[model samples]
Target: MRVIAVWSIKGGVGKTTAAVNLAALAAREGARALLWDLDPQGGASFLLRVSPRRKASPRRLARRSVELRRMVRATDVPNLDLLPSDLTYRTLELELNARKSPSRRLAVKLTPLDGHYDWVVLDCAPSVTLVSEAVLHAADDLLVPVIPSALSLRTLEQTRRFIAQTRSKAVRVLPFLSMVDRRRRLHREGCERFAGGAEGFLRTIVPMSSIVERAAEARLPLFAVAPSSRATRAFASLWQEVREQSASPTD
Candidate 1:
């Protein structure tokens, strides 16, 4: 399975939104997709209308006492499953650090799910913690949602440097602009600067829209709520780019 992590060290960059929409789009295209909500806040789980069960203990999950598959729950979307996140996941870093090869723990846990899923979309928490490190090691592609701003661009560069420091040749970093408002001069300038598809940045720019916010309130992906919306089309284009890139041989 191709593991795509929707992550950023900085929060509120539309990471969870991208994760849910991309996963939904993958499932819509008949791919068996699992959305693993790794954020302790459970944004993706809540957005998907899946509640976290009390049975999921952070230590047990980290130690493999409880199998990953057992925590998998089906969502309303066909072919889309969810591994719900719990508040206890806040302590998952400690548990993972207590284990050997902590950076590879998540990848090892996902091994058994290889044949069952075509795509595993990870909704990651915003931080550079042990959990984030594990995600960096586990994921085949890092889908970073960057707002069109100087700080967001800096964060994206930091993420690229982090990946380079890991020397992980297998994982690719795909950064895309999110919450872009063309009315704002900075937003328009940022889009024009990075939208050229240079330095591996995605060409798709997700615009700020009330329809996207409505999808969260409606507890559904934008594709299910308003497929024809500009935001939804942007996400669809982003998914298409991701699919094409994932299929190509690693450089």
Candidate 2:
């Protein structure tokens, strides 16, 4: 299976939203997709209407006491399943740091499910922690959501450096502009400044919209509720970019 991690060092960059929508679209396209909500906030789990319960301790997952297979749960969406998250996940870094080869632990656990899933999307927490380090090693593609701001660009730079330092050069980092305000001059300038050349940024931009925010209240992905909306169409385009990357991904 190809693993995609929807991640960003800064919070509120539409990270989980990207993960949920991408997974939903993957399932709609008949791919067997599994979304793991690794954030303690359980954003992806909540959107898919799955209860945030643990079948096993995440701390013991790397040690083999907690098997990744047992934690798998079905989502209401066809061809999509979920691995829920809980409050305990806030302390996930501690457990991962305690393990040997923690960076490889998540990838190792997912190896057995290679034949079972077409895609495994990790809805990661917003941080540069041990948990994210594990995902950095595990994921084939790291889909980063960057808001139109100088601070966001800083984090993206940090992410690039971290990946380089880890020598996980096989991981393809695809950064994109998200929650962009078209009326803002700064937003337009920021996108133009950082979204091309060697940065490997995507051209599709998701505008800041109320439809996206409503997904949280509707407890569904934007595609499921407003397929014809501009935001949904943006997600579809985003999915296309990722699908192409998955076929022949590279650093």
Off by over 4 Å in 1: none
The RMSD (Cα, Å) of candidate 2 is: 1.7
Please give, for residues 1-251, the per-residue lDDT of candidate 1 as tens digits. 99999999999999999999999999999999999999999999999999866777788788755679988999999999999886878999999999998988998899899999999999999898888888988899999998889899999989888887776547888999899999999999988888678768899999999998899999999988897999999999999999998999877
Q: TM-score for model 2?
A: 0.94
**Clash pairs detected, candidate 1:** none
Per-candidate count of clashing residue pairs (backbone under 3 Å): 0, 0
Task: Please state the error at residue 25 of candidate 2 in Å.
Answer: 0.4
